[model samples]
Target: MTETTAEIVLFDGFDELDAIGPYEVLENAAQAGADLEVDLVTLDETDLVTASHDLRVEPQGTLGQPDILLVPGGGWTSANEGVRAVVEDGVLPDKVDACYTEGSTVASVCTGAMVLAEADLLEGRPAATHQVAVEDLEAHAANVVDERVVDDGDVLTAGGVTSGLDLALWLVEREFGADVASEVSEEMAYERGEVFG
Candidate 1:
């Protein structure tokens, strides 16, 4: 396979679990000698990012061309605004759109799939996001589904909050092997649920 690198994008009000759950799984896969590297990235110039829950994290830098580019979503908080803020701003969505020129696989967790939709990435594709926002996704012309994960070629999407773990584990399992993925899942004490295509 090609060189495996994952870039997890973070914005001002990203989701904590949506970003971190997948990070942990990919990190564990790297630790197990999977030849995969995972990095937290952002479209913002500053390295620091505040999650929707007000938790702060520092990204390495802006996004780089990687084998995987994943977006994470957080709830809409009156104070933080989370994915709503991202949708309104369109900065991160622009960057997401730029990644399509690269050969990496693109994916998202929760309403981050909405970010992909906003970027016009899901124009005629079947995708999945948080079920609560299915209407919003459909508005963007995405064939939204209720499944936990939906894979459409290079564009993959996951549902709700916890499904980030399942998506990441499935990615690891797909690129590496069931054994390596199982080990990472066991390390995380997480069950890798069914991933739909």
Candidate 2:
């Protein structure tokens, strides 16, 4: 089987849990022999982006098409102004659009679904986001669902911040194996939750 790499996109004012949760989960999957490479990346080649709590995270790579492209959501979701500006005018949409064209698996956590929606990728797909952003999500996609994680073929979305971990574990189990995911969860001391198909 071919190895898969997942690129986690970080931006200014990003939520801490949005990126960290999936990062830890995917890292654990890699350690469990999933052969998954998790990369923290940003719009630029290298720079430190400030999270919502003002925590700085240095990205290892530039936004590149990967097997999976993950986007996170947080305080930036409020008013849709911040996220809209970035998604509509910034590099986030461009990067996601490119990945979509390449048939890459695109996933989002929390309000990150809004970013995808703004990019016109979620127009007719079933997706989930933070409960507070459900209306925003539904506005973009008519098939919005109320669930922890909504897997609509290539587009997978998780609800809220903490759901990212569950999404990552589900991805590992889907792409690798149940045994690998189980082992990784045990190693990380994370309990596996129900996966949405």
Question: Tens digits of per-residue lDDT for model 2 on 1-197?
Answer: 77798999988777889899999989888987888899999887656888878889999888888999999987654544435557756568777988988988999998888888877888888888888778877877547777788888898999988889889888988899999888978888888667576
Angstrom error at residue 99, model 1: 0.7
Clashes of each: 0, 0
Model 2 residue 87 CA deviation (Å) reads 2.1
Error of 1 at 19 (Å): 0.2
User: Considering only N, C-alpha and C atoms within 3 Å, which residue pairs clash in candidate 1?
Assistant: none
Which residue segments of model 2 deviate by more than 4 Å? 77-84
Could you give candidate 1's per-residue lDDT for residues 1-197 as a string of tens digits? 65588999988778899999999999999998798889999875685888877889988877877889999987643343778888788887887888866677899999998789888899889888887788888989898888888888889999999999999998988889998899998888887778888
Task: Name the 10 consecutive residues with the lowest summed lDDT in model 2.
Answer: 76-85
Listed in order, each prediction's TM-score against the native is: 0.93, 0.93
Each candidate: what lDDT?
A: 0.86, 0.83
TM-score, candidate number 1: 0.93
